[model samples]
Target: MSRIWIERLAVVLAVVALAGCATSKEKLLTHDDRTMLDIWNQETGGPAGSGRASRELLDARQALRRPLTDTDVQTAPGVQTRYTRTAQNEIYRQFHRLPNPDLVMYVFPHLTGTDPVPVPGYSTVFPLYQRVQYALPGERVEDY
Candidate 1:
């Protein structure tokens, strides 16, 4: 009887531990991960794998040219817009145009220390939201 009880408890604990290790599908992106664009083709399929190595290169170039500031982020209609206009523009101009319309742009305000004066900087990454089919062309197209 005691052995049976111990076995049940062990099984329950094992299940809990496994559950804790599981990560949601939504939370899958990691730092070293290749972008969605790199994995897909123009056909709108899953993970075709590898193309246009310089896509983010353009975005980086654009960011380097622009003054990355907190004010710039606040003034823009939204986060995505700021990236597309300022950072992405520079990237597009400097290198090949970004084919993915739904590209995600990230802007992070960081500091030297854990909590020092927030030194402003920006980064852009492709987001799944951009991949969603739009009703019409252009940003804020659904507003109409």
Candidate 2:
């Protein structure tokens, strides 16, 4: 067959397919004004057995259901008990600060810079580590 004839045939086939789809969609959309209850009644047999199947199904479901106790609902995953954060755990649970004891240092009296003047000493406290350390997710970190 010629290329032109093939193109015309393809266009005709497309048009026929589109027409078929439109008719089918129209038939599906055109339904009688029946309420949901009427449709449900027809599905289970007839209007005489309306709500009988629904009641039986609900009763069976209720028999399977059980009462939930206090243990059913739990707090956050890692928490065994609930309490206010006081010391190290005060920080976010994800990045817990590792224990680092504070070091007390005393600066002795010394000469002033650029001048021959005497300066009194003072005491200061700083963490043992220069930077605050954090424990990893699964690492064992003691909470006191």
lDDT of 1: 0.60
Q: How close to the true structure is residue 14 of candidate 2, measured as C-alpha lDDT?
A: 100
lDDT of 2 by residue, 1-144 (tens): 699999999999999999877767656777789988889778875565346776787789999999766666554433533244556556658566788899999999989878779989989999898888887754745684
Which residue ranges in model 1 land beyond 4 Å of their true spot? Answer: 25-144
What is the RMSD, in Å, between candidate 1 and the native fold over all Cα? 24.8
Candidate 1 C-alpha lDDT tens digits along 1-144: 999999999999999999988988668855546565755543444333334545555567888896759898786767566445566566643232233444557667767886687868776766554444433223332222
Pick the TM-score winner. 2
